[model samples]
Target: MFLNLLTLGVLSLLEGRFPARRDPGQRPLNMAIWLVNFASASAAPLVMGAVVAFSRRTGLPAFPVDAWPPVLAAAAYIVAMDLGECLFHRAQHAIPVLWRMHSLHHSDPCMNASTTVRHFWGDVLIKALTIWPVAAIAFRPTPSTLAVYVLISLYHYFSHANLAVNYGRWSWVLNSPAYHRIHHSREPQHYGVNFAGLFPIFDVILGSYQVPDVTPQTGLDETPRGLFQALAWPARSTPGRSAAQGVGAALKAPS
Candidate 1:
């Protein structure tokens, strides 16, 4: 699982760092900002690992991954984890605070394979805070279980890509880029739809699944983030910030 996640993350970095133009006007995402995001968001797994290890070594059982109550078996836990992620990802869209943290990801003007790597550091911190489900799968995980984690992550990357992978019936069963592109779409209607990481079933059950009746083209269309600004975006963008900007922009007189 570790190797697979490592591979997928590296590929995401490469694509975001050296992006291909889908349109003539689109600029590649700024590398420095992307790095900050990558570094910040990617810190979670490492942090989670350190926390779990330190807890065990210090003999602190509270919040220990190994100390999870046996509420459900491993198999059930995996299924629950998928649902939890879907729910959590959806909440990032539904909740205003989470969306503020997540907006850096959508700030990418263009949607492509590389855009998947663009993220805010706060999101990474959130991920580390949310990794208990993995620990629940195992206090000491097996190779197969780890593989499952990697599989879902890779599946997640592709879902965010701007590729044209036609998955017919499978698209109904699994989350596809076609399905996921809607989540990244600038259109207001598609803004928060389709939040599944792997299993679309969770979305279906939760009534968040949305399949577009017509195909939508994908690519980066926004001005790419400048190196310094993107890195500072989360820090500077307070809840009042968005509100002030929205109201201030509206109050501006027409040119």
Candidate 2:
């Protein structure tokens, strides 16, 4: 809770002083999204806790990394999980079904720290399904490491901020706002690019990295109007076409 407040406070200040764009109208919608996501986050622990209990009872093949030094174990877990996230992010763009749900996040026209909370409720379910399973069976990360990972991942909220910052020579190590902005770019050329969350090295390795010439036009032309519309997006389909087809029209190439 303190981390959430600190992140929002700092990013809000930065964005107010040096916004990438004036989006006063988007503020309310952004906050609504943030609140909804926060509610979802609040319930996530119970869901994950249940999963962990189930995994333990089922005799899942969990790796015992407890014997390793704390620092080394934490470092390894961070890298492994981030790598998995990068791959899953790429899949979110490529798989039509996943894209349907993920589109809500990318629908934010004005990228800011608030845009981090633009994820749909389905996104929470998706995360619950994917992440904990890996953590349970692949590597049993210590509670301290998990807490540290959460703090580091929260920086992603800042990464989406309107601040015009980039890591320059260190872009490969850290994912800068400029690097992530390119992923949110509306251009077809930028589709399925820059899937990194904490590290841009994945994009570099996978050939999805593109240095933005300009901020580029962001968001879909037909973005949802309010929270209800955003939440209902995955279900809203035309008479003849499925939602997947509609999303596929917007996302041309996922490379």
Candidate 3:
């Protein structure tokens, strides 16, 4: 928790120093979402515990990381978990049901460090039911390995930060802010590209890689207005209207 706050504070500072774009109002909304998620984070361990238990019951073979050196094991685990993240991220974009929940993350017009934790709270359970189980079964990662992954996952704050930083040639190897910003780009050309969480190698291999061209504007064309709409995003509908169209109309409606 302390580390997360420190990371958010540091990245929030960097975002101020080198902002790609500013929407001062968005930060408070992102922080509110983060607060809700932080309170809900307690349930994560319980969900993961259930996932691990289910994996054990499956009796499926897991990677023999215990036989490797500690550093090597950790490295290998990170890579595998990153691959899982990359695939699941792609699924989130490709699958409509998942996208309904995921659109909340992409709705942040001012993608900043705080936007890293701006996911809908229900995404936790959705992932627990889907990708988390697969990862648990495949890796059977020890507590230390999971802890290492959590530490590395802090890169997400940096990745989502509103900075114009990108690795030149190395952009294909690691996920930088610029690289990830494209993933959240509002431009149609950038849609469905650059979905890797930590490593971009998976994107390269899977053929979804796209170099960060310009720091494009991020977020949906029609974003949810407030916290209520954001949380109720998936279920929001009106008779004879598509969800997207309804949302668009809602945004256009008078206060």
Per residue, candidate 3 scores C-alpha lDDT tens digits across 5-119 of 8999998888888798776437777877878776557787688778778767878778786788888887877887788777777666666667777777887777888888888
Prediction-by-prediction clash tally: 9, 0, 0
lDDT comparing candidate 3 with the true structure: 0.75
Higher-TM-score candidate among 1 and 2? 2
lDDT of 1 by residue, 1-255 (tens): 355356556655665555332532122443444555666556766777776677657665433334455433344556656776776676666566666656666666556555566666677687676755245423444456556655656666666655555466566588776777766655544544667777777766766667744345442233334766565555653544232222122122212
lDDT string for model 2 (1-255, tens) is 678768978998998998766753265787787676777777776787788878878888766688888998888889888887887777776677777777777777778787787777877767777775576556777789889888888889778888788777777788877888888876766776778889888878887776654676567656778888877877767312223323443334444
Q: List where candidate 1 sits over 4 angstroms from the true fold.
A: 1-21, 24-34, 50-78, 131-140, 217-224, 235-255
What's model 2's TM-score? 0.87
RMSD per candidate (Å) reads: 7.7, 3.2, 5.9
171 in model 2: Cα distance from truth in Å? 1.1
lDDT of each: 0.56, 0.74, 0.75
